[model samples]
Target: MITLLLMMGTVSLSVAQVSESTLIRCASTEQDSLRISKNPALFKLRQQSEAVIQQYISRSRVNKRTNADEIVTIPVVVHVIHSEEGRSMGGAGNANITDAQVNSQIEVLNEDYSNTSGYKGFYTDSLGVDTGIRFKLVTIVRTYNSKSQFSPITDGDDLAEISPAWSTNRYLNIWVCRLNDRYLGTSQFPVVTEINNRTQGLATSEDEEQDALTDGVIIDFRYFGRNAEAITSRIYNLGRTTTHEVGHWLGLIHIWGDRNCGTDHCEDTPPAYTKNETTDIECTPVFSDCRGVNTRNMIENYMDYSPDACMSVFTNDQMERMHAVLELSPRRAKLVEFSKITTDELLVDIYPNPVQETLFSSIFTPNFEVFTVSVFNQRGQKVIQDKLNRTSLNVKNLPSGLYFYKVETASKTLTRKFYVR
Candidate 1:
């Protein structure tokens, strides 16, 4: 079962939009800086998370076993919040995206992250590695709002105003809607802290609940998925907006590091004087920075602000840094574990027809080694699956539909039907 909050009283404010020629306007670092300033305690947490990553990197250099080659699968849930007019209009209009468009974006993510795309031939010698990260679509949510566009004083506030997210520790929640501004996308970085006695080191719950309302990505519907209609801009139509934002989500800073000759914490990516040349889809010319060092910048790196067609690689150091975040960050680690958990457990009850917020299930026993619960749609397709160690499952994010659930224990499997209204 899920909790729904209705927001009252909205203030509309005007802001600058992105230029028509710009490829992507990622506001992740800007949003993160604001959050750290407002909550000073997060400064220390950020320091701690960085320290862990540095230590992990140092150890990996000395010991080969420090980092494993296991692929990380991240569950995704897209929240499509559209105006009634947009919903009625449908197709590729603003705030009105089709399911195929969403799936195309996911396909792009898998290809780019795995380096399996047809454009892999463009990878330069500087290309170092594949991030070994993959995404799975867990569900899709559609919401209706009268507001044509949403602008958050903070991205967190905007998420709360539109749709509440699923468990951030378990799933990546993406909010796709019409933006009053010109930004293509924004994302939240991983943070380390403790929450409710749980090791939510990567992302704390209180901050995620209040300051960061939802911990994931927010994309403009026009640039969300790859399709002729949704591809409002020729340069950004390849579904790389979500790809770039997810890089930030997984701790990959811009290749230029958002500063002149700044460090992106990766050794392989050459230092750039600035990210000014990223607006174009062509290869950048060789240039020297303040250090008088001249070299051709890796304009093709995904972390750069380059157009989707010009981006292709994640250097070895970048992959190592992201893998470290996955292994050392507690919340991220737990999420991976929860995703891999599977078993058979006896279920006693799944109650309350026309489920309002959360759905509750009573287990016959709690001593099973591994118990799993999953939900399926009327078509018998598995829509939601997670370790059911607790008595409740959040269904608030589920659209109004008929669904069935199966509980698996060591000795028995139980199935039930429920509806969300």
Candidate 2:
């Protein structure tokens, strides 16, 4: 057991595995501890990152800077590391899951994050809400390896090194492979202090390079997609494992804080205890001791260790926390800046492909008068719809992400893509 005195308190992390189909849920906490042990500077970096995140949240709340309606899209790259047996499909133990499984997991992420109605991730709880965050699968790379399973604790860096990442700052890289029976997945938490240091002239070349290499989420192949055929445990075949790990990638800790009756820092998330290595998959209400009072655990929360079927929501505060990370965190913030739309269409010229303050739209040839501009996020949600009486539009409030803008006149309509940084 490795004990570390975190800002919350002294947390002990045990690194061991009993089986692959039960008990152990995720080894993110243990993997984090291991990383910190290898690089002691990470301890201070995480502390600083948390402090900055808290401050950002506080200020945003006070100033009402929350982009509650803006949808931030993230580009994803899935690296499938598997053995020769993985090449075959339609089996209970196949490591290289099919493309359908990979796509199913993507659908699950969108459904859960947006809380699509009638989906498994939808809940009736008042605290549950649509996070307005979506993910786009940019690429999938399958590599055949001799190793059948990788250790979540020790082989994380090795796995990442083998397949490597697709520009960590631009994409959310997920490595899916066979993991030791103990863990379903692990995620590398984002460190913002190192990025902040770049502007403050406190970061070194070594810090930046290291962050680029080991900054992403990792998932066991079996627990990767929705009802993945290879997953032996029906309890976790719903693809929530990937959702849970992605939550960590977006700067969320376990609901229980990886300790007994601990705090996850989100005000809307009630205090709870760890559910690791437990067979309690029931959706029945569970309680934990918080300070002196008995508090009901939010087993339905994605950050909790509840089985895939039982977990369904992300609280409002949790949404804000994730959005804050997307807006301020280093690589996380950049993921939203990539636009899939092509820029070759000829109609009007949009100045400043990446506009931070104002976006100016100049028509090459004015075929008609009285034009209007409409901006839609990557999720096709129209965030800005207004008449373009003037050529310039104020986009200072749009959260950092890729967006499509449409300028419609009396006779013609033009659509193009733009970015907000």
Candidate 3:
């Protein structure tokens, strides 16, 4: 029998290690960093890997990835592993970072990724360019208690996943947790890396784990920083941290281009990396520390190594590169595939919800797999016939109009409509 390997299906977190029944309870605790130390194995491994990666970068010369579109929408799971304090708000001078902070971060991400207020002279042409990237803070807290069942604390993005390590096509997966060993956050290397979760080298893919544990991004409660765990009223706001990490998640190389600027493939971003600085510095605009000429320095971009407040703008070239990345990367294209959607049988799906030309679906569930989905125009003409996983017909040839779709995956199949603008 041919079987489907799904990431984010079921993952049993070692919750017992921290001696907490709920993740929310755990995140609320005000543990000192001195008290908590990094796991020897993870620390050593990260160190060694980073060093080797640097060497590899020096040996090879490739353009750095600094574009936003290259990184598709990565589904994020924010684990608000609270401590005993339970949404502990240490108010006043040390008032805890409230749920307001969490919501604010989500808002910020939306505004930032959507490039709403962001297109102000940040790019080279100085004209506002919209970055077609979306960041959704998942409302579901996909956690596994001792019982091996999904815990109920999911409070971020609620877009339920079939598993972890999504197709890398339609959606990017992110897990926000405080469970790592003294680290703020970490992510898997995109495609063709020793860290390939599918091979179980560094991280495990969702398909390999057979649960919902492997698909999304994980941010720690303690360092998810301003978002969920401002419990101590202490906001260790590192704007570039999330921006930087997400850049990596989206497959953008550092603006400084790792060892030198020539390796990462970004001609515009120069090599001006400071090993580890606590504060943001004034960098050269179009500065070419490594490569010469017309360099934008690009340090101020979200993908660069600048501070959060300092980072702004995504170049048009970056947008094109990101699209190119989408075309070439398999995991990226999987976002639109049926393999990522959940099969509760009740979840509704609309093909061409934002239909450019045509739409398709192969929705199969426990209740119904061979159901019919009808398409209707504003005039309500049944214009199309579609069978899930049956054919790849041409819908693009159709005229632009308000179209409705009716699909049946299981017990009760229904219809939904969208316009083909």
| Candidate of highest TM-score | 1
lDDT by residue for model 1 (170-217), tens: 677799876644677888888744333334322323344453346788
Error of 3 at 240 (Å): 4.2
Scored by lDDT, the top model is 2
**lDDT-based ranking:** 2, 1, 3
Clashing pairs in 2: 23-277
Model 2 lDDT per residue over 77-189, tens place? 88888775437754555678888888888998998888762434323466788998888887788887766667777776777667876556556789988776467888887
Q: Could you estimate the TM-score for every candidate?
A: 0.74, 0.73, 0.48
Runs in model 2 lying further than 4 Å from the true structure: 1-21, 117-124, 194-204, 339-421
Lowest lDDT 10-residue stretch of candidate 2: 7-16
- For each candidate in the order shown, give its overall lDDT on alpha carbons: 0.69, 0.71, 0.41
What 10-residue stretch in candidate 3 is worst by lDDT?
26-35
